[model samples]
Target: MFDLRMWFRALQIIPRLSKDEWDRLDLVSRWLIATRAAVFVMTIVSAGIGGILAARDGHFSGLNFLACLIGLVFAHATNNLVNDLTDHLQGVDEGNYFRAQYGPQPLEHGLMSVRDVLRYTAITGAIALAAGVWLVAATGTAALGLMLAGVVFVLFYTWPLKHIGLGEPTVLLVWGPLMVGGTYLCTAGQWSWDAALIGTAYALGPTAVLFGKHTDKLPADRAKGIFTLPVLLGEPLARRCVTVMLVLQLLAVVTLVWRGALGWPLLVVLAALPLLRDTAAVFARPRPETCPPGFPKHIWPTYLVAYAFRYNRRFGLLFLLGLLIDLALR
Candidate 1:
C-alpha cells in the first residue's frame, strides 16, 4: 500500500481528495500531500546550485551538501504545514476559500485535526532542526546564524509576512540568499556574495509563483484581510508585477554572464526566454472566468499560478543544468 503513484502525483500538484480517499492513502502520500511537496523541487534546485558551485570552487563536502539538501526540504515542508494551520486558525481559509478549492487542506477539508497537523509540524521541524544543528556544529557560527534566520522566516512567514506585503519578497530572500548562499556556506565553509547574487535569479521563479497564486486568489485574500502583495497591488498591477519579475530573472542571469562571473555555458539558460515570454503572455491578461479549452479542469481556479509553476520549473532546471555544464567545462 505504498501507493507510489499517489506519491508521484502529490509531488507534482496538490491532489484534491475526499476524507475517505485521504484515509486510504499511505503515510508517504499523506505526508507529501500535507506538506505540498510539489514546490520542493525549487528548494532542490537551489541546493543543487549551491552544491555545484561549491564543487566548482573545490570546496564541496558530499556529507554537508546532502545534509543541507535534506534540511532545506524538511524546512520547506514544515513551513507549508505551518502555513495551512495558521491560516485555518485565523479563519482565512473558511467557506471553501481559494486554498481549499485547489488542494486538500487537511484541516479545512476535514481530513485532519489541528492536533494532527501540529504533530506533523513538530516532527518535520525537529528533523530540519537536527540537520541545522549538525551543520552549525560542523561549520561554526555562520551556519548557526543562517539557521536562525531560516527559523524566523519559517515560523512567521504566514502570519505577519503574508498578511502584509512582505511575503513575496521574503520568498525571494529565503530561497536565494538564505537557502542557496547558506548551502554554499555550509558546503564550502565560506560566504560568497556571488553565490547569493546568482541565486536571486533562480529565486525570482518561486517568487513569481507566489505572486501568481496570490493574484489568482486576490479577491478571496482581500476579503479575508490578507494583504498579500497582489491584493495590495490590484489584479492588473499584480499580474504585471509577476511579468516583470519573470523578465528580471532572465536579466539577472545575463548580467552575471556578462560580468564574467559565469562561463559561456551558463548562457544556455537564455533558452528559457520563450518560456518567460509565454508566462508573461499569460500574466498580461486576467484569469479567465472558466477553465479554457484543453486546460485541466481540476486546476481551473489556479490559472496564473499553474502557468507560473510551469515556467519556474523549466527555468530553474535549465539554470541548474547550465550551472552544472559550466562547472564541468571549467
Candidate 2:
C-alpha cells in the first residue's frame, strides 16, 4: 500500500527510521528521505526566480522553463546522492557522525548497500543529464557550458570541495550565478547580469544554511579530518560569518533595487526581515552543548542548520513572491 503520509513526512523533514521502519516505506518515500527533498524547495525558488525574471523581460518560454526547473531539481537530487556516496566511501559519516545523527545515512545506517546508492545516483544523474542535453540542444553552447559546470560541481563537491573549505563558496556560486542565472539564460534565450545579481543575493540564504550545518558539525568534522569551512575557521568565526551572510542577503536586494535593476515591488522581500533578525540572533550565540529545552527532540543534533534552513526558506519564498509582484506591476 502506498503511504501518502510517509511521503509527505519525508518531504517535510528527514525522518529518522529504523531498518524495520525503512523496510515499510514506499519507494518514493525512501527516495525522498534519502535525497533530503525538504531542501529541494531552494532549487525550485531559484528556478522560479529565473523564470519569473525571464517572463518579466518578455522572453519567457513555458516549455524551456519547465525543462529547466525539472533539470535543476534532478541535478540537486543527484548531488545529494553523490554527497552521501562520497562521505560514506570516505568514512566521514561513520561512528554516528553528525550527518548520520540527524537523518538516515542509508549506507552508514546499514539500511542500504554501496550498490544501492550507486544505482540511485546513476538513475537520478541520468535524468538530470538527459534534461541538460535537451536544454543544450534547445538553447545552444552557452547552455552546454552551464550544464558542464554543474556536472563538474556535482562530481567533486563532496570530495575535495567540501573537505577543503571550498564547499560553502561553491554553494554560493552554484545556487546563485549558475543555477539561477543559467535558468534565466535557457528560458529567456539570453544572459542578464541583473538576474545574476538577484541570484547572488538569494544564493546567500543557502550558503548560510551550509555554513550553519558545517558549524554545527565542526567538532565532528575536525575530529574526522573533514576540515570544512567551520573546522578551518573555528566555531566563533564561522558563526559570525553566517550572521554576516544573512545580513548581506538583505543588502544585496537593496542594492539591486537601488540600481533599478529590480523595481520597488521587490522590496517585498523585506517581509523576511523578522526571520533575518531571528536567525541572526541565533547565530549571535554559540550552538547549545545539548538540545535546548522545548526544542524538537528528533532535530536535536542539528541546531544552527535548522534555524538557517527556516530563514532561507522564508527569504527564498518572499523573494519569489516579490518577483511575482514585480511581474504583475510590469
Candidate 3:
C-alpha cells in the first residue's frame, strides 16, 4: 500500500539518506515535506484572516479568497524549488554534503541529477506563476505586483545577487515579512498595519536564525567566493549583528502593543522557550562545526511555528491573536 511504503520511506530518510548520498526520493521527499508544511501554514494564515475579515465586514468573498490562498501556497512552494536549482547551479554547494549543508543535502551527494531537479523546478514554478496570474486576474494590479515580486525574489535569492552576499537580507525581506505580510494584504484587501507588523515580526525571528546559520559557515562560504554578511563583515561583528536582530524582534512586540496591533496576550512570544535555547546556542558556536545549526534547523522554523500558536495552529498565529484583539476592542 502507498501508506505502508510512505511510512517505510519516511523512516528510512532519518538514518539512510541523512548520511548516505542523495537520491531522487531523498530530494523529492525533503522538497515535499517543506512544501507541505509551507502550504499548510500559509493556507491557515490566509484562510483565518480571510474568515475574520469576512465575519466583520459582511462582504466576505469566499471562493475568490480560497483560490487566492491556494495560489499563494503554489507560489511559495515553487519559490523553494527555484532556490534549490539556483544553489545547485552555483558551486556554493559543491557536492560535499558534509561541508555545506542545509535545506536539501541530496543535491551535493550526486543522489539526484541537476537536470531532473531543474526540470521539476520549472514545472512547479510555472504552476505557481499561473496561480499568481490567477490572483492578479481576481484582485487586479496590487496582487499582480506582489506576486511578481515574490517570484523574482525567490528565484534570485540564490542567483546573481547571492553571489554578492545579499542572501541574508534577501531572505529577511522576502522570506520573512514580505511573504507573510503580502499574503495578509492579498486576503484582507487594503493594507492593515497590524498585518504588516505582525508579518515583519513573523519574518524577523526566522531570519535571525537563518542568518546565524549561514554565518556559521562563513569560513567555507568565503573560500568559495560567496559573500554572506559574516564573510563581508567578519565573525565577531556578525555575532553582534545577531544580537541586534533579536533585540529588533523584541522591539517589534512592543511596537505592536503600542499601535493596538497586538493584544496583551501577545506576550505569549515568551513561549518561545526553544528560541531561548537557540539564543544560548547562537552565543556558543557549534562544536562539530564552528557555528551553530541553531537558527536554520531549530530557530527559523520555531519562530514560524510559534507565530502560528495563537490562532489556527498554522502560520501567523501570534499575529492573529493580535489581530483578534484589535478587532475585539475596536
Candidate 4:
C-alpha cells in the first residue's frame, strides 16, 4: 500500500527501513528513500528564496519559477543517486562504511540492484534536463549557461570533486549562488548580484550539514583515501571551520540589511540564533564515539549532521518568512 505517512516520515528523517518494509514499500516510497528526499527541502528553500527575490524586484514568473524548482530538486535527486552508485561501485561502502551505518545504502544493503538504481537515476536526470531545457528555451542563454554549470557539478561532484578536498566548497557554491542566483535568472530573465549574495547566507546551512557529515566520516574517508575537506583539514580544524561558517552566515545577513539589500524584517532570522548557539556548541567539540545521553539510539552515528539539518531547516523557514514580510511591506 502507498503509505502517505511513511512517505512523509522518510522526507523528515532517514528511516531505517527493514528488508521486509523495503520490499513492501510502494515505488514512490522506495524512490524517496533512495534519493535521500529528507534533504530536498534545502534545495526547495534555495529556489524559493530566488523566486521571492525576483518577485520583490518585479520580475517573477510563476511558470519559470516552477520550472526552476522542479529542475533543481530533480537534479539534487540525481546527484544523490550518483553518489550512492559511485560509492558502491568503488567499494567505498563495502564494509563498515559510515554511509551504511546511519542509513540504508540500497546497493550495499541489497535493497536495490545496480540496474534498478541506474534506471532511477536516468528518469530523475531526464526530468531535470527537460525542465532545464524548457527554462533555457523560455528565458535565454543565461539560463542555458546556468543549467550547464549545474550539470557539471552534478556529474563531477561525486567522482573527482568529493574524492578530492573540494566537496565542501562545492556544496557551498552549488547550494548558494548557483541554485539561488540561477533560479532568479530563470524567473527574472536577468542576473542579480544581490540574489547571489543572499543565497550565500542561506547556503551556509547546507554547507555546514555537509561539513558535519564529512567530519563524522572523516576516519573512514581518510582510511579509504577519499580526501574530503574534513580529511584534508583534520577533525579539529574542520569542526572549527563549521563554526566559522555558521557565524559568517549571520554576518552575511547583517551586512545585507545594513547595505539595504535586505530589510529589517530579515532580522527575524535572529530567532534562530539560540538554535545556532546550541549547534555551535556541539560543533565546537569533537563528536562522541558513543551516543550521548538522551540522544536517540537509532541515530547514534549521525550526531553533527542531524543537528546541522535541524538548524538549517529552522533558519531557512525563518529566512523565507522574513523575506515574505519584507516583500509585502515594500
- Most lDDT-accurate candidate: 4
lDDT of 1 by residue, 95-119 (tens): 9999988888899888999999999
What TM-score would you give candidate 1 relative to the actual structure? 0.98
| lDDT per residue (tens digit) for residues 231-251 in model 3 | 798876776666666667667
Report lDDT (CA) for all predictions: 0.92, 0.91, 0.55, 0.93
Give one digit per residue, the lDDT tens place, for model 4 in 18-40. Answer: 88989999999999999999999
| Global CA lDDT computed for model 2 | 0.91
Runs with alpha carbons beyond 4 Å of true place in candidate 3: 1-65, 95-104, 273-281, 284-330
- TM-score for each prediction? 0.98, 0.98, 0.73, 0.99
- The candidate with the higher lDDT, 2 or 4, is 4
Determine which window of 10 residues in candidate 4 has minimal summed lDDT. Answer: 12-21
- Candidate 2, residues 1-330, lDDT tens digits: the string is 789998888778999999999998888888888899989999999999999999999999999999999999999999999999988898788888988999999999988899999999899899999989999999989899899999999999998998889999999999999988999999999999888988988999999999999999889988988888899999999999999998888888898899998888888889889888888898999889999999899997999999999999988888888889889989
Error of 3 at 319 (Å): 4.7
Error of 1 at 10 (Å): 0.9
List residue ranges in candidate 1 displaced over 4 A. Answer: none
